[model samples]
Target: MSWITQKLPDVLFIQEGPGIRKYEYEENGYPMINVRCVQDGYIDMSSARCASMELATTKWKHFQVDEGDILYTISGTIGRSAIVKEADLPLLMNTSVVRFKSLTPDLDPKFVYYYFKTDLFIDELLGHSTGTAIKNVGPSHLKKMDISYPSLEEQKRIVAILDQAFTHIDKARALTEQNLRNVRELFESYLQQVFSLIGDRYVEEALDDACELITCGVAATPKYVDESEGVPFLSAQNVKSGKVVLDKYRHISKDLHAKLTKKNMPKKGDILYSRVGAGFGEAAVVEHEFEFSVYVSLTLIQPIEAKLDSYYLKYLLNSPQIKSLARSSITSSGVPNLNVKSVRKFLITYPALQKQKSVVRSIELMESEIGNLESIYQNKLLELDTLKKSLLQKAFSGELTKNMGEAAA
Candidate 1:
């Protein structure tokens, strides 16, 4: 059978929600589905806000989402879609989340949902979308969009094949994601075990006593320059949990670097700790003798080599216990900022220098193993996503039906 093409409005009824004001929102009433509630193929109503029953029934009655209705995000992150189930009934669509219902029996809602997942549809939608920062598409844009499908029977067959294929793909993707999580948790568990059990040989002291100097970096923003004319600058973002990342780092003029380094230079064996914003509590030891100046968001820790191992201190700072402590110490007034005084007061528990090195070696070895597993699982996830996209492309191109017929023969 050949495919028939029609405008989306001729086959489906498309409508977005009423613009609800903050005052219209309430503690209990009809659940309002927003763009955030719409995942790729399912609705996450957990974060859905509530609108008053009066508003839902009176002003927004026409916007009520029905069972089997497909919800597509029209603004911000465009083209993400989800099919509304029976359990999701009685929910009202909020702005930016448009609902689609089949206007003709020839169109299977599930088939249309799968088509939305296709790159062809998404690319067209994106092309028509407007906005530099947050892209948006109106119902009029969707109304003019083309939708192609075969007979009703063939549509159901395509949906069935896609359902089975995507089920397996999604299962594999879920397992891969869980494996990635497990690999990360393994490293965290090891860190927990190492730090939680303090032995008789362990000596507990404040970081102030164990470190030769603990100071933050320059408060003033440095004048940036070309790499050849300046030195690498470090910030909270440059410091990862266990290592420094310079791939996206900026360069500051030599004069500015020299001026900043006079008070807060990070040399070899020093620890760079992210002390503010999203990266707070993360620490990485400086293993190179290369010159760099840090931002105020980073703290420089020069550990007394005789008393504490630099790697040990770094691992400790990144440990679950210390991270929890650091979170508790964060200033409540502004952006999540960890005060330098909190770093000075941090309790450091350690054994002899040799034992500290031994612990570091063990953790590093385990980390290497976990890193390999993480890479494998991550790659598997990427592969699964590619497979899914390939299946969608084939399904929409009519090749999937042809392949299925050959298989049946």
Candidate 2:
């Protein structure tokens, strides 16, 4: 009962603007921050902007969010929070926005920041949210908010523990992220080394001499009755993020698949590259067993696995140089297209089958290590996030005090 009203310091609602909902704006409306600017877990100033600067002096002057302010989205994308990094820039507070600033020296700002990130606070915020489609929360709701923390020393201790813990976790995660990037760069570099073009210094060999075959799919608008009756129409859309996203996979009738060119069904090992639309030339190997009903806008590039490795070649096609060259060859303005003929012109070095296998083996090894590091840190971060949530729950509910002496020490 006593904890319910601990007489904690005041936490104000984000500063509200003078303008009401659906209000008409003048030439320079209030310069409120955009919702999109406050991205998940961070503030993206890249797209952050003010509504307009013109407002009455009394309203306009106080709207500016200062440095060291903690901002949270009180409207759209509820619970999205981040600390304002750029203190110099004067950004008008957006609607349903709130800030927590001017903390006493006894309180730790980092503790305050972490405290706001807990499920307890989120539940408290969510409990107050009103409206079905779009939850609207304003100043009155924030002033009534409550949170509990230990004494100043405990607060500093909690922040210190979190700081050391997150620092270690973050360093590991950062290294893994960097390693993945390095592997990608290494693969790209290998591609360039294979296909060097200079002032008539490098040899330009025909792609056919290097690759086994380049096959094009059929132009068929396959019919779709039901997922129970038809096979999935594997289009370029399925080739997303370097893998097939089967959730939105389309289906085509059996009759349509029969009428469509036999080449429409790509066999395993064939590299499928999107040949039409905005995502042209993005390729992925057909690794899974699926009925492929492809469009003519797509092409299949394959190499005799004995003579050339498809993964290595797929890496080559995705390289920046090759992609730029392919983009330049597109003729249609409305829908950019790259045919099999144009793809045959793609230059690459044919470093004997043995060396090709060696390159593949080396990349595979590095990729495996990078994958492990990424998975490890990814799992660790998830655990830390969950721990943060659990700790926040305990801290607010009084359970956090059991270990308070040890943690504080």
Candidate 3:
């Protein structure tokens, strides 16, 4: 087998999109391909913005994206590539996404696109990239990068093998993803069933009447200190997956914590509810008796031990119905907020304390089972990804065709 190596620009033409201003976007027109549109292997135009024909023909006349062009994201979330098809026509490129075309007939675009999937290519691309937080690579950087390929015929053969292999791998991946979704849905469905199908022994009460206290945390920002010298501070971000995660928490001076906790101290069994921003409606139970001061973004709920189970209330708040009600009541004037008044007015349905404990146990058991299944499926997905990279490595290393020839012999 013979292979040729050259700089990317020597065999491919690379161009990125012009910066389209906010005012230029219209209700409907040519699909403007942004960085988001380029998925792993194909372009998804569902969320694409539009530019008018006037802009496409005038200022952006030469920026039209054609079929057979390979699109690569050159900015944040770099290294994703896709091939444009007929259905993706009349498309125009937006900033940060670059299109590549085969400058020579000897090179296959699909071959180069597949190479973009390899770790070798990604490592090289990142080596040429710049920036600390958000990495970026330009067409000039891509122009200087090297690409190695066999003859066009061999390239097509390798591409054919990859396409067939990936088709099966992708299908398996889709099914595994669906299974993961189903497991999560099962938990959610059971929660809905448990909450909705209440027995005659159950009673409904307002949250204000059920809990001893329903108040938010400190409003004023506190002075910061080193982790070893200060008290742990909890915020909405600390509450996730139905538990308080202190792994990435910040620290406040002990005096500030003392002042803050006087008004709002989180204790074991207290439920921390996210009140604003993206994490709103998420609730978690404080399982440990750790000293922590909460941020204003978190609402602390102290359930009356005799009346309500803290775990039960935590699960109830996270239920789909309660979440829906919370969404409806959220004040979106600024950040989406779940005010104390709104939370107090929420309806709480429960059975006897014994029954509540039983329900909690059942839900916890089911959650554990679902978590195990999720781990299995997640591992399967990782294995599939590894398999793909393995196949790409073999194909490019010439071992794939060599193995095929030996099998034929």
| Candidate number of the best TM-score | 3
Candidate 2 lDDT by residue in tens digits, 28-55 = 5544566666664567666544454445
**lDDT, ranked from best to worst:** 3, 1, 2
lDDT of each prediction vs. the true structure? 0.88, 0.65, 0.88
| Model 2 stretches astray by more than 4 angstroms | 5-11, 14-32, 39-42, 55-63, 74-78, 85-88, 95-112, 123-172, 183-226, 234-263, 274-282, 294-309, 319-345, 351-366, 380-394, 397-409
TM-score of model 2 vs. true structure: 0.64
Clashes of 3: 0
Clashing residue pairs found in predicted model 3: none
Q: Score every model by TM-score.
A: 0.85, 0.64, 0.91
Worst 10 residues of 1 by lDDT: 400-409
lDDT of 1: 0.88
Q: Per-residue lDDT of 89-169 in model 1, one digit per residue for the tens?
A: 778989898989999988999999999989999999999999998999989899889999999998889888888777877
Off by over 4 Å in 1: 196-199, 215-235, 247-262, 275-279, 287-297, 330-337, 402-409
Instruction: Write down the RMSD of candidate 3 (Cα, Å).
Output: 2.9
lDDT of 3 by residue, 207-270 (tens): 9899888999888887779999999888899888788888888899999888777865778999
